[model samples]
Target: MHEMTIVAGVLEIAHRQAAGAGATRINRVVLEVGRLAGVEADALRFCFDVARSGLSAIAELEIRDVPGRGLCPACGASRDVDELAALCEACGNVLDISGGRELRVLSLNVD
Candidate 1:
């Protein structure tokens, strides 16, 4: 599955970062995944567990789900957005998505 590829990329990044910092292992990893990032949380978690099996450095994976958000230039209103329909709640206008499309590493605890 694509989750395996995603997990492999994450492991590679974590390993590189840990090695660069002279850390023998990773204690934890915190990830920020947005609602519109198209990633399934359960799949990612399972893949991460499988990928980190031999890597002693990665002990834990923490995922933070971020809500999709949008901003309306017509009414200067900004609020949480629905991924399917980005509409401004204040004015019922089409809004520009401003957030909640991220898939990135937030932090890591290495030692």
Candidate 2:
């Protein structure tokens, strides 16, 4: 799965940071998972454990979910979305994506 590669990338970054701080262990990793990022939280967690097992920073994972913000193309109104994708409910028009496409580590904790 692509999640393996994605987790590997995260661990690589963690390793760099750990080396910079001379840390022997990682305690936590805070992740932001946006609704439009197309990354499954469960799958990411599974991959993260495997990826971090042999690494220096085998940190605990914390995911913060971010909801998609859809702006109406016709009226320019912004609202929270609960449906399949970015869509405007007020004007019945396809939405222009305003936010919520991010998948990244928000912060790292090391010891």
Candidate 3:
């Protein structure tokens, strides 16, 4: 699905960074995935495995999940979330999420 394409993009960028930095291999990649990023973690992992072939970096990847933060307007609280339907724990009001809906490369550890 779209995860394949997304993984492809990731590889392209990681390849460039690794090559530019004169790193023999990319040891790890840290991605910040938002709760509403609409990306399936399992699917992304599988796609990454398939897409990283023949690249300068060997087939090794480490994924770190970043939880989304939602705002409880009714309660004026900020909370972390893993689900789309987030409710305020203080008053059980529907929480409005402001950030963490984007998939971004936070950092990469290279050799």
Candidate 4:
């Protein structure tokens, strides 16, 4: 799955950052994943465990799911959205994406 690749990238970034900071071990990884990012949280967790097993430093992974939001460009209004293509409630226009497209490593707890 693509989550494997995503976890690999995250591991790479974590290693780089930890090494730069002179950290001998990684204790935790905090990730902020948006609902619209198209990533399966369970798959990510599984892949992270498998991927980080070789590293010994990474101990835990925490995922934070963010809800989607949309903005109406015509009416300057914003609201929670469940789908990618949603019509604005204020105006009939197609809503622009305001949030919930994130796939980021929020923080790392290391030693």
Best candidate per TM-score, number? 4
Error of 2 at 66 (Å): 0.5
lDDT of each prediction vs. the true structure? 0.83, 0.79, 0.79, 0.88
Measured with C-alpha atoms, the lDDT of residue 47 in candidate 4 is 94
lDDT of 3 by residue, 19-79 (tens): 8898887777777777678888888888887777544346465666667888998879888
Residue 106 local lDDT, model 1: 87
Q: Rank the candidates by TM-score, best first.
A: 4, 1, 2, 3
Q: Per-prediction TM-score, please?
A: 0.88, 0.86, 0.76, 0.93
Query: lDDT per residue, candidate 4, 43-100, as tens digits?
Result: 9999999899544345698999999999998998889988899998767899998899
Runs in model 1 lying further than 4 Å from the true structure? 53-58
TM-score of 3: 0.76
Pairs of colliding residues, candidate 2: none
Instruction: At residue 110, give the lDDT of candidate 2.
Output: 87
Return the top candidate by lDDT.
4
lDDT of 2 by residue, 4-76 (tens): 8777887778778877898888788888888878888899999987778543435788999999788887998
Task: Sort the predicted structures by lDDT, highest score first.
Answer: 4, 1, 2, 3
Q: How many collisions per candidate? A: 2, 0, 0, 0
Model 4 residue runs over 4 Å out of place are: 54-58
